[model samples]
Target: MGGAFLAAAVLARLGGRIGLPTIPLFILAGILLGPHTPGVVLLSDPHDLEMLSALGLVLLLFYLGLEFHIDDLKAGGRKMAVAGGTYLALNVGAGLGFGFALGWGTSEALVLAGVLGISSSAIVTKVLVDTGRLGNPETKPILGIIVVEDIFLALYLAALQPILSGADSLSAAVMDGGKAFGFLLLLALAARFGTRVVGKLFNTKDDELLVISFLGAAVFVAGVSEWFGVADAIGAFMVGLMLGSTSSGARILKLVHPLRDAFGAIFFFGFGLSIDPGDLPSVVWPVLAAVAVTLVMNVLAGLGAARVYGFGAGPAANIATTLLARGEFALILATMAAGAGLDERLSPFIAGYVLVLAVLGPLAAGRSAWLARVLPGGAGVCAGRGAGRGGGLTFRRRVRVRGGWSRSSPRPWVVVRLRAGGRFSRSSPRP
Candidate 1:
C-alpha cells in the first residue's frame, strides 16, 4: 500500500503536467499494476485494499459535506429550488431518454438515467479546489446543487432498488426509501442542533481525540447508512455536515485533510483494480458516445441552471465546467447493477465513460478562461480574491510600484499582489 501511494504521487505530478485529473492517473496507475495486467506489482490480497478504498469513499464524501452548512440549504431560497429542480429534470430526462433510445429495458434504462442524473460531488469538489474556484461567487450555488443531488440519490435509489432487485413488494421499496429520507432528516436536525453534542464528544485541544472521534463517527454513521439501505457515502457525509455546524469543525477539517487525501488516492486506485483492460476495446465506442452526450448535457444543464439563479457569464461557465466531472456515485451505481446481474456490458460502459469524463472534466474546469472567451461578455470575466476593502485582482496591467525612500516623490507606491490560477492573490487598487 505504501509503495502504491508513492507511485500515485509521482503519477499525480505527471497528470498535472499533462493537464489531467489526479484521480484518473491514480486509477490508471492501479490498472497498470493490478492483477489483470501482466505479472506486475499486484497486491497479494485485494480485499484489504478494497476496504481501504471504501474508507476513502467515506472520507471523500465526509470532506465534501464539511464544506457546507445545513443553514446554506435552508436559506437557499426559491432560486436554489428552481435551479436545482431544472438541473435535475434536464439531466434525468436526457439520461432516461437516451437509455430508452438505445433499446434498454425499464430497469436498465432507470439505472442508466440515475447514473447520468447526478454528477460526482467528490470529483466536482476536487475540481473546485484544483481550479481555485472554491471562493468564486458561483461556488455557493454549486455546493447547494450537490447537496440537493445527494438528497435525490436517496429518493431515487429507494424508488428504483426494488424494481431492479425484483424485491417482493412496493411497501418494501417504500420502507427502504423512508429509511433513507428519515436518515437524512435525522442528520439535518443534528446539523442544526448537534453542536453541543459534538463539543462534549470531541475536544478541540486534543488533536488525537479529535481525529479519532471524527473518523469513528464518520465510519460508524457510514456503516449505519448502508444498513439503512442508503449509500455509505451518505452516512459519512452526514457526520461531516453535522460537524461543519460546530465551532471546532474547521479544526477537525484541518486535522483530517492529510488522511482524506491519502485514503482518497487509494480509493481511486482500487477503482482501477476493478476495471479489465480486455473490456476497453469492446466498450470504446459506447464510452465515446456516452462521453459526447454527457459533455453536451452537462455544460448545458450547468449553464442553464446557473443562469436561472441570476448568475452572470463567468459564474455560469464555472458552474458548467464544475459539473462536468462524473465519478464515485456513477461507479457505485454501475457496481450495484453489475452485482445484481443487470448486464455485463453496462459495467464496462460506465467504467470507460467515467474514465473519460474524470479526465476531461478537470481539464476543462482548470482552463475555463478558454470557455469564457467564447461566451458573451465573458472576455472581462475575472475571479476576485477577498482582500482588505474588497479589492480584486485582474489581468489589466502590472506595475513595479516602489515603496519608500523616493526623494523625488514623497508618496510611495506598493506592490499589491501576484496572480495565481487566473485569479488574483489579493485585490489591489485599480491604477
Candidate 2:
C-alpha cells in the first residue's frame, strides 16, 4: 500500500510537468512497478491493494455525487435521456456488430456490447476536475449522461448474469433485474425524501466524527447495494447525492477532497497492476478497431448532444472527447467473462482497449480546442449563452437611440433570453 502511494505520487508529479493527466500516470506507475514487469516490483499481487482500490473508487463516485445536485438532475432530465440514449445506441450497436464479426459466441458479443457501450464515470469525473471544466456549460450534460449510464448498468449487469451463468431460465434474469432496479429505486427515494433524516444522522460539530459518519454511511450503503446486485460505485454516489442537499454538503465536499484524490490514484494503480503488457499483443488489431469505433461514435454523440443543446463546435468536441474512456466497468466485465468460462480472448481485448482509451481520453479532452478548430462553425458561437437543456437560444436587444447608435455605445445590449419548450420568460420582451 505504501509503495503504491509513493509510486503513484512520483509518476503523477513527473507526468504533471509534461501536462499529462494523473490518471494514466498512476496506472503507468503500477505497471512499471508491478510483478508483470521485470523491474523493482513494489507489489507482486494486485489483490493486495484490492480493498484500498475499492475505497478509492467509492470515494471518487461519492465526490461526484456531492457535486451533482438533485436539482441539476431534475432540470435536464429529458435532454440527459436523449443524449445518453444516443451514446449507448451508437456505441453498443457498433460493439455488438463488431463482436459478432469476430465470430465470438452470442454471450461474447453481449459482453462486448456493454464493454464498449458505457463510459467510465471515474475517469470522466477525474478528467472534468483535472481540466477545470466542472463549471463549463457542457459539463451538466456530461454528468447527466453518466447518471443515465449508471442506471443502465444495473439492468445490463442483471441481464448479463444469466447469460454468463449459462442459465436458460429467463425468469431468473428478470428476478435479478428486478432486485437491482428495486434497490436503485429505494436509494432514489431515500435521496429524494430522506435528506433531512440523513442530515441529522451525520450532524456533528467535530470534523473527525463527521468524517467517520459520512464514510460509514457511504461504504455501508455501497456494500448493501452490491449485495442487491447494483454497482457499489452507484451506491456511494447515491449516498453523496442524499448528503449533498443537506447543510453539511459543503463541509463534506471540503473534507472529502484529499481522501478522494489519494484513494483515486491507488485505484488506478491497482488497475495497472492487474494488467500484463504481454497480453496486449494478441488483441492489438481488435483493440485498435474498437478504439477507432469508440472515437467516431463519441464524436457523433458529442455533435448530436451539442445540436440538442444548441452549442457550437468547441462544446461539442469537449462533450465527445470528455466521455471517451472506458475503465473500471469494462474490467469488471472482463473478470466476469473469465469467471464464467467465456472466450479467453475477451480479457486481453478489454484490457488493451481500456488502456488505450484511458490514456487517450484525457489527452483528447485537454486538446479539444484542436478538434473544435477543425469542426464547423466558430468555437465561441453561443458560448456561455445559457445552461444546458431548455435554454439553447440567445436573444440580443439593441436600444437604438439618437444619432443611429453612436460609436460610444456600439455593441448591442445582450439580454440573453431563454425560450425553452416553446415558453418564453414573462419578463422578456415579446419579440
Candidate 3:
C-alpha cells in the first residue's frame, strides 16, 4: 500500500506536468503497477482494493452531497431546470443508445449511460479556474447543470445496485428499487427541512469532535442506506446534503477536503487494479468512438442548456465546451459493475474510455470558443459580433497582484491570464 501511494504521487505529479487530470493518472498508475503489466509494483487482490475503493466512493459522494443543495432549482429558477433536464436527457440517451448498440443488456446499458452521461466536477472546475473563466457569465449555467446532474445521478445509483445484483427475479429487483427510492425521497425531505434540527443537535466548537461527529454520521447513514438497498454511497451522499445545509457545513467541508483527496486518489487507483492492460486494445476503438460522440454531445448539450437559460451563442458554446470531462461518477459505475460480475468487457471498456476522456475532454474545453464559432450559430465566448473567424477575449491592463498593478515581474508565481486568441495564457501576478 505504501509503495502504491508513493508511485501514485510521483506519477500524478508527472501527469499534472503533461496536463493529464489526476484521477485518470491514478488509474494509469494502478494499471502500470497492476498484475497484467510488467509487475514492477504488485497490485493487491481485486476484492480487497474494491473494499477500500468503496469507502472512497462513500466519502466522495458524501462530500458532494454536503456541497449540493436539494432546493437549488428554486434558486436558479426555470433556467436551471430547463438546462439541466435537456442536458441530461440528451447525454444519457446518447449513452444508453450507444451501450445497447454495443450489445450489452439493459442493466449494462444503464450503467454505461451513467458512466458517459455525467461530467467531472473536479476537472471542469480546474479547466475554468486555469483558463481564468471561473468567474465568467457562462460558468453559472455550467455549475447549475452540474448540480442537476448530481441529483439525478444520486437517484440513478441508488436504484442501480439491485438491478446489477440480480438477487431473486424482476419483482425482487422492483422491490429493491422501491426501497432505494423511498430512502432517497426521505433523505431529500430531511435535506430540505432538517437543517436547523441538525445544526442545533451537532453544535461543537472543538474541531476533533466536529470531524468525528460528521464522519460518524456519514458512515452510519451510509451503512443503514446499504442495509435497506439504497446503497452506501447514496446514503452517504444524503448525509452530506443534510449536513451541508447547516451553519457548520463550511467548516466541515474544509476539514474533510484533505481526506477526500487522499481517499479519492486511492479509489481511482484501485479501479485501475481491476483491469488487465492486455484487454484494452480489444475495446479501444469503441471507447474512442464513445469519447468522440460524448465530446460533441457535451458541446451541443452545453450550448442547448445555456440557450434555454437565455445565454447568447458565445456563452452557449462556452457552456457546451466546458462540460465535457467525465470522472468520479464514471468510475463509480465501473467499480460497481466490476463488483457485480457484469460483462468482463464493461470494466476495461469504461476504464479505457475514462482514461482517454479525462485527458482529451479538457483539451477540447480549451477549443470550445473555436468550436462554437464553427457551429451553426457561429458565435462563442472567445468570438465577437461580426462574421468570419471570431475573436476571443484578451487582457490589456497591466497585471495586478495582491496590492497594486505591476508593469513587470520580479520572480515568478502561478498566474493565469485570458487572451483574445485563446481562452487562457500565462502571465505574472506581480505587485
Q: Where is the poorest 10-residue window by lDDT in model 1?
A: 384-393
lDDT tens digits, residue span 294-358, model 2: 99999999999898877778678889998999999999999999999998999999999999999
List, residue by residue over 1-431, the lDDT tens digit for candidate 3. 77668878999899779755565677778889877788585665656676667677677767766655556534675788788888899889999999999997788899988988888765565456445564465666776787667667656765676678875465665676677677767876787788899998778999999999998898889888767665576678778878887888888889987877677678778767766767789899889889888977877786787667665566666777667777767877887898998888898898788777766666666566666667666532344322112334433445555655454655344455444233545554433
- The sequence of per-residue lDDT tens digits that candidate 1 reaches over residues 1-431 is 98789888999998778656686788887888887788676674556597899898899889877876677667875667677777788778878887787675767789888777788776786677656655565777887777677778888988887877888798988888888889888877787787778767775688887898999999999898888766788778778878877878889889878888999889878877766778778879867877777777867776777677665565666777778777878887887888788877788877777777777877777666566556666666554421111333343334434552233553434334423232444255533
lDDT of 3 at 108: 86
Candidate number that wins on TM-score, 1 or 3: 1
Scored by CA lDDT, what does every candidate get? 0.74, 0.86, 0.71
Candidate 1 Cα deviation (angstroms), residue 149: 1.5
Model 3 segments more than 4 A misplaced? 69-73, 103-111, 118-171, 312-323, 326-347, 362-380, 383-431
- Candidate number achieving the greatest TM-score relative to the actual structure: 2
